[model samples]
Target: MAARITARRPSPERRRTARMTSSDWANPYGVRKPYGSNGANHGDGGEKGATLSADHPLVPWKQPDHVHQWVDVDHSREELDRFVRNWPDLGELLDANVGHGRVVIVSGPPGMGKTTLIHRCLYEVQQRVAATGPSAGDPLAVFVPTAGLENDGRRISVDPDGSFAPTRLINARIRSEITKKLLLHEFSESRVRAITAEEDPYQAYGEMSDLLVQRNALLFAVIPHIRWNDAHLRAAFLRTCLSHAHTRIVLFVEVSHGAAETAREVAAALSGSAAVTHLALRELNSEDIWRFSRSARAANGAPNGLVEPDRSSLMAAHDEWKPSDVRELRKVFHSAADALRRAPHPWPIDADALRPHWERRRAGRDALLRHPILPRSGG
Candidate 1:
């Protein structure tokens, strides 16, 4: 029988010391509290707000897992169809790269849903793996957000408690756990070997290379904004990963107007690598945008009797909600979908335009409920 692991209880003195250390690392502004602890009082010198509760919106859910939803990129079904259909190309590219030990770089402007597309591909691959099992050797996708890594490496102001109060400690913990799980799941045996190997700790890339070699899994590294100076190192890593025939890698760099030059430089460096395939994320066409919105609405179930209004209805509603322009409307719809997924309670639709329709439906239901009272079977 497998041995059971039990939780260990810490002594009061240890708990107090831990709390003090946590408080020391907490944010001065107290915007972000310590994990499992509350913020320090801003007005009072004493730690007044130290209650443990699930008040933070970012806290992990304790009940049923929420479903995922999306916003329409724009009002375009045709474009969405194209995007979904084109997703297979990514898988094909991955398979081809894995065969030859190559790298595929996905680069695009911010808000183009590059990360979302990556997640979608990973989700599909996971489903396939679930259906076919390990014998099929389904490709594993790991996302490493560079921003999180940078934040982890950067020094933060700490309090006497040795805690990061203002910093997003929960977010950091969640991300760390995610990264840990990905690494463990992808390279279990290789990880053990890497840890046991007698190598200089400073030369960490070599260990990563070893892990990749052992697992034969594809790594999806997301770098939001690429820097010109980091190009060489990034290129080196890609070259190393692709040196082995079983390892496939992809670097998704998200760029914006301010970082256009950096994107250009990085693109140039990646271009020199024969193993890398670079693709830019373009804006979604109107049809694609529409489809995204529709899909998001459908995934969230759109509520009973809340028929997804046609594009015409949206346009009409857009005219009425003037100050809340089309852009605002889109944002609201996106938020609504997200709420439907993440919110604990069913999201209520209270928009002035939607309210009347819902009210009418309620009235019809009430009438049906009263039908039995108005007429008897004999009458």
Candidate 2:
């Protein structure tokens, strides 16, 4: 997943997320695309250009670090129920990880918010970890995807043009950034090592697994596809059992019709070694689509007046969203948020200011189903 996410998108933050991970978002997917792809800004939930269309957006949106955090409008209690209500409770996951490491397998279809759920839970754990910095004996947590680290061993590189670039992919950058933002601490180098072919991915993995056995580290493994790497994953799971540290492995496997068999095989591998729990992400209903999505709220509070979409209007628009188009929702929100930030227009944007892009988005909605890897259901 890290490799693919990095290659598909050009956003460095997204790429860094693929490399280092560790975002507290319960939605565990990396925002970056794989290397050499132009559409990476859409991966994860970061925004690059302020607009969604080739043309400039209505509200100029710009933010450093590609993070788009739209402040949702004051929602009605009944309408704004958390989309992530069903998974193993965040408190439970944290307690398990902090007390005795746990090996949990979370399975969900692509775009079913698997990444989001993981990220949400991760953020809680991160906050807890940060509140009380870890000592050598305490367990530290790292969020990583099954794709492993994609960057070469070096932390930064010198380009031919003389611009120095980060050697690690966007994943590394994200892990580093999240630590500073949430934990108020720099990401420690000792916590993550650049895996080289010389050292081998599994060798590095093994070393990390050994730490878990020692009770020094906790790993949140994001398995993009259950069917993709059964044998290798099984080996890693077995390693956790050897740890006297109460080490545990948490797995988030993306599901498809054909994935169940592979999941069972992995469960069999764990057998007596680790306790396992299975979780299926909830499919988004219309209500969730509204809550998890964006509105003109953030800009509304600005000195300049803005157009705020009424609930009826917002629900009507959300109704058009295809459930499988979950990833697209992120793109839309990021784009809109960024556009608002950078737009040259006066304070508080109105619907008229947003209609052009909204129209374009709606027109393109049907095309999202053809998106590679994540098509909107019935799109």
Candidate 3:
């Protein structure tokens, strides 16, 4: 009989110091909180986030459990087509923001890596801040996801015990950003609400800006949700930020719906303003068939992802796959891989070996995609 595992309760002493303390070497922040304890973890590289040279905890949902080490820069470039377009390079975005303080709106379809690209860019920019102070050499930059903020501009939260509790994640992020002197906010449209009398994006933007000004920090906000609502002039918010800051402002608006309308709004909003640059992302033009579609018999002879000689057929294929759909495509690929994990050391993941399973997945993948995306205009 197999032994049953049970949840062990922590003793009083253990519970008292349940939290992990951060070393001065690990992170500048004193106490590091793990994921799901109170809120999400901010950019602390765990075993998962360690895959990349820089730590990005905000978008952990997008991380792959096992990316084959064999995939080189060329392979990743070929595989990740979404990041290649609007962002030809993350350095460009960083340079524009750091050098000019420009607001860059990255518009694209859902799952096309808008969030992934933004996070990656911010991570690289932040490394400069981590190494030297924003005042030391380079301007400091910090990445913040605004899903947790309230529109009233309130930064503190009250617990049931009537004690004032601030979001550790936001507090940690703010501490890092203010200390560094750059604030890169990842503001989401869905989660934000109007706490103050002003509407969302405006009210929220005002509050955040006031906080940054109070702290005397430079702002570099990246908002994934820039909805197109022509009914009200949304340009006011962008214009407001631009007017206040002597520096250029960036708005990385990843629009899932109304890309055309959103772009038009941006252009109209910044008609006189030359600082705001809007970049649009489209699908990749490449061969649908992958050379590595030999996952079935190919898995048998390979030593941990290294395929053997000649008996090669990789897993994962798509007839009508789009570049932006890579995230969804990986979900299907991993699901198939998980289903086949126990069968053999290397699962036969070729088209023939996995087609039936994929068909079942397609047939049953009936859930409506919640995020609305505009069609890619052109290459």
lDDT of 3 by residue, 131-214 (tens): 544443344344444332111112322223433332332223323333233312433222222212233333444454544333
TM-scores across all candidates?
0.43, 0.43, 0.48
Full ranking by TM-score: 3, 2, 1
Candidate 1 lDDT over 1-379, as tens digits, reads: 2222122233455434433222222211111222323322322122342322211111101101111333344322233344345433334434533444344454443334444444443344344444544553654555554444222211222223544322233223323333464556745745544543424422333344446545645555544332212345445533443442233444434332223435455456446655554544544443443343354422111222222324544433333332111222333453443333333333223243333333344344322211111211211
Off by over 4 Å in 3: 1-101, 129-140, 148-216, 226-250, 258-274, 284-316, 320-324, 364-368, 371-379
Whole-model Cα lDDT of every candidate shown, in order:
0.36, 0.36, 0.35
Alpha carbon deviation, residue 224, candidate 3 (Å): 2.4
The local distance difference test score of model 1 is 0.36
Residue 312 in candidate 1, Cα distance off native in Å:
4.4
Comparing candidate 1 with candidate 2, which one achieves the higher TM-score? 2
